[model samples]
Target: MEKSKIWVFVSVLCAMFVLVACAPGSGGSPTPTPLPPVSSYEKSIFTVEEGPIVEEKQLMGEIVPSRQEELFFRASGFVTRVSVKQGDVVKKGTVLAEMQVDDLLNQLQQARIDLEVAQANLAKDKAQREYDIQKATAEVTIWKMRVADAQLDYDRAVGIQKEKALLNLNIAKENLALAEAALKLVQENTNPYMEQAVKRSQLAVERLEGLLAERQIVAPFDCVVLRAIIRPGQQVDAFFVVFVVGDPSELIVRSPYDFDLASKMTDKIEVNLYFDSKDEKGYTVSYLPNFLPVTTNKEATTTRSSGDYFYFSLPKEIQQQDLKVGRTVFLKVILGRKEKALLLPPSAIREYKGLRFVIVQDGEKRRRVEVNEIGLKGTDKWEIVADLKPGDKVVGP
Candidate 1:
C-alpha cells in the first residue's frame, strides 16, 4: 500500500509540472494589466483673468502718393524722344515724351499753309469784286452822261440829224442799262464756295494739330516723374502708360479696399501702418472718406467712390521718409476691444460635437462648464462668456 501511494504522488507531481509548463508564463501570451487613472490636475491648467481683449486685423498694403498722374499716349507710335526721365521735376504742360510725329508735323504745316492760301484767295476775291463793282458803276455813270448829251442834240437838230441823235441816245441808254446790270450782278454775288473752302482748311489745320498733340505726353501738373516707362525708340500702343508722375511732397498709403474692414470701421477707430523697410514701430494715419475728391490725373478729379482702393493720409514726418511707391506695407486695425474681460487661452476651451465647453475646477472637484458666447477673439487669448468667474481655473483638453 505504501508503494502504491508513492506512485500516485509521483504521478500528481508529474501532472502538476506538465500543467505548469503549459501555463502562459511558459509559452502562451500574457494578459495585460490596466494602468492607474490619470488625474485632470496632471494635464495643462489655466486660470482665467481679467484683461484687455483686443482684436486686430492685419492687411498688406502699398505706399502711394495722395494725388498722382498716370500719363499715357492717346495714339500709338515709335517713341522718338524722351525729354524727361524718372525723378525729373517739371511744371504743368512740360513735355515729357514724344512719339514718331514727323509725318504729323509735316501734315500740320501743310494744313496751315493750305489755310493761309484759302484765306488769301478769299481776301483776293473780296477785293476783286469791289473793284469790278466800282468799274461797272463808273461805266454806267459815263453812259448816262453820253445819253443826256445825245438827248439834247436830238431835241435841237432838224429831221435827219434828229433821227441820227435819237439813234445814238437809244444806243447810249442800252449801254447804261447793261452797265447797271453788271454792277448789280457784282454787288449781289457771294463767293460761298470760296468761303466754304476757307472754313474747311481751318478745320483741317485744327484737326491735324489735335492729332499732333496726341503723339506727345505732357505733364498735367507740377510734379516729379515717379516713373518713366517709355524709353527712346520704344514702340507703344495707344493709351499705354508712359509716365507716372506725382507730387512727392504729399504721400499716402494705399491698398485694395477691404469689405471686412469697411464694415468694422467707426468714427473713433484708429489705423496703424507698418512699412516693410522699417522697424516694427507703427505709424498712425487718417482714413480718407470716399466722398473726398482725389485727383488721379489732369483729365479728371475723381472721388474714392469711383475707385476700388483705400486711402490713408500719413503724417508729414512719415511722408518725408525714404519710402518708395509700391513698397509693401502692413496695416493693423483694432476691430474691437474690451478693457476688463474674462480672457483665456484658446487651448483651455474644449469643443465636442457642436458644444463648446471648458473643464473648470471647483475646489476639489472638476466640472464641465458650457461657454455661452465667445467675443473679441484675439491672437493669443479669447474673450469667453461662461458661468465661471474670472478667477476660475480651467483644464486644457
Candidate 2:
C-alpha cells in the first residue's frame, strides 16, 4: 500500500510540473506561428521600343474669307427695297438694300432746287451791278464828248456865244462828275450775303443727300453677298447689319487662336485640314499667324481682338463650290517629332510626390527607375529619357 501511495504521489508531482510549463508566461519566450509565404503581385507589363514618335494637336476650325465685310444701314428706317440676295455677285458701291427715303428724297430735291435758285439770284444781282456800272461809264463818255463840242463852239463864237458855250460846258462837266460818282458807287457794290445764302443752300442739299445715303446699304467691295437680312417694308435700327459680303476668290481657314498651341507651333510644321461638310479626307497645308479684323457686329466690336485668329490658305485644287463661309473644318497639326527614340506606353509611367518613374523588370525582380526627362509625348506612347535600353520590360501602373 505505501509503495502504491508513493507511485501516485510521483505521478501527481509530474502532472503539476507539466501544467506549470504549459501555463501562459511560464517560459522565457514562445515561438511565433510561422506566416504563410507572401505571393508575388503580378501586373501588366510592356516592353520599351526604339522608334519614331510624333506628337500632334487636333483643332476644330472654320472656312472664312480672307476679306469680308458686314453691311449695315447707318440710319434707322423702314426697308423699302432689297436689291440683292444671298449668293449675288456685286461690285463696289452696288446698292444691296434701301430704306424708307421718300421724305429724304423730297427734302434733297427741294434743297437742290433752292441751291440753284440762290445761285441764279446771286448771278442776277452781279449782272445788274455790272450793267449799272456800264451805263454810268457810257454816260460819262457822252458828257465828256459834249463838253469838248461846247468848248469848240465857244472858241469859234464872240462874247454872247462864248458865254452860252461856257455855261453849257460847265453843265456837261457837272453831269460827267455825277456819272463818275455813280459808276464808282456801282463798282463798289459787293453782295457777300448773296454768296453766303448760296453756300448755305448747297450745305443743306449735301446734308440731305448724306442722310439719303445713310438710308441705303451699299457694298464696300466687289464681293458675293452671303446674306441679306432685310426685306421690303421691314423696319430696322441704325447700324443694323443688312448684308454679309465677302470675296470668294480668296478663301482662308480661320480658327480661334490657342496660345498654348501657338507657342508650340513652328513655321515648318505642316497642317492637315478636313472639310466637315464634304466629309473629305483632308488637305496638307501650311499655317500662318494672322490677325483677323474684328467684325462690325456690336458684340464682337466691343470685346474681340484682331489677334484672336489663325489663318490658313486652302489648296489650289479645292474648288469654290466645295467651300462656304462658316463651314466647319478639322485640323491636325504636328506639335513635335523624334527619330529613333526610346518610346514607352503612357500607362507605364508612374508619378509619386512629383517624382516620375517606371517599374522596370529585370529577370525575376522589379525596381523603379526615375524618368529624368520626357520628350515628344504622343497619344499612345511617350518618349522617356531614363537609364533604360530597348527591349527592357516595364510594368504598367
Candidate 3:
C-alpha cells in the first residue's frame, strides 16, 4: 500500500511541474507588453518661435465698375443712327447717337405755317388800320366842308330872314359832329387789334424755335459708352435710357460687406486686393462713396448673422484690358502687426470659459498652461501673448 501511494504522489508532482512551466512569470525577465494603439486624428506639437506674426484676414468682396452712367433720352423720336458702341470713348458734344427729326421737322413746319398765317393776319390788320386812318381823315375833311357850307347857308338865310334854310344848316352841323365821333372810335379799336395780331405772330415763332431745339441731341460731358440699347430706326420713348455713358477715370468699386464686419471696419480703413489676373494689384481707401443696405440668405452663410449688410464702395484701378465687372475677390485689411511674437499650433491651445489653456507633456506628466490674446497666425497656427518656451512637447487628442 505504501509503494502504491508513493507512485500516485510522484504522478501528481509531475503534473504540478508541467502546469508551472505553462504559467506566466510575475518578475525576472517578464514578457514584453504591447504599446497602446495610436489615435487616428491628426495632431501637432507646439514650440516657441521668434518674429512678427502676420494675421491673414479672409473676406469676400466684388469687382465693380468705378464709373457707371445710364444715358437717358429726354425727347421722344425715332433713333436714326448709333454712332458709337459699347466700350467706346466719346467726348462732350460728340454725337454718340442721332435721331430721326422728320416728325419734329413736320411739327416745326406746321408751326411755321401757323406763324405765317399769324403774320398775314397781322399785315391785314395793319392794312385795315391804315384804311381806317385814311377814312377818318376823309371823314374829318367832309365834316369841315359841311360845317363851312352850313355856316355859309346859315349866314345867307339869317340875312334873308328865311327860317327853313337856317334849320337845314343847323342839322348839317350836328351830323358832321356824329361822323367825327365814329372815326375816333375806329382809330382806337383798330390799332389795338393790329398790336394783338403782331403779338400772336411773335409767340408762334417762339414755339417753333423751342421745337427745333428739341430735335438736336448732344452729350453733356466726356464719357465712355457702357451700353448701346438702341439700333438705328428703333422708335424710342423719351423716358427710355438709350446709351449708358460714364466717366472711366472716376471709377468706384461696389462691394457688399458683412454687417458685422462693416461695423468693425472704419470708413478710413484701406485694403489689399488680389485679382485673378496674373498681376495681383491693390487699392487704397480714397472714398467711402455710398452705403447700401441689403438682406442676405440665412442658409447661404456660415460666418455671418442674418440681417442687413452694407455694400461699400471702393476706388477703381483702371486698365486697358476689359476688367472683370462682377467677380468675387479676397481682401486683407491691416489692423495691427506684432513682431517677435510667441507662436504655436492652434491645436495645441484649448479654451475654457474665455480662458485659453495649453496641455504640456513633460516626461509622462501632463500640465495645463494659461495664455492670453491667442491671435491666429495661419491655418492651424496661433500667436500667444505668453511665454511659450522652446522644445516643449504639446499634448492634444
Which candidate gets the maximum TM-score versus the true structure?
2
Number of backbone collisions per candidate, in order? 0, 0, 6
The lDDT values for all models are: 0.82, 0.83, 0.63
lDDT tens digits by residue: candidate 3, 78-190:
77767888777788888676676666677677767866777788788878878887888798788879878877876777555557767777777787887788788877775
- Which 10 successive residues of model 1 have the least lDDT summed? 298-307
Residue 285 displacement (Å), model 3: 5.0
Which 10-residue window of candidate 2 scores lowest in summed lDDT? 294-303
| TM-score to native of every candidate shown | 0.59, 0.63, 0.46
Per-residue CA lDDT of model 2 for 234-280, tens digit only, reads: 88887766677888767788887888887766657888898763555
**Ten contiguous residues with the weakest lDDT in model 3:** 293-302
- Cα lDDT, model 2, residue 135: 94
Preferred candidate (lDDT higher): 1 or 2: 2
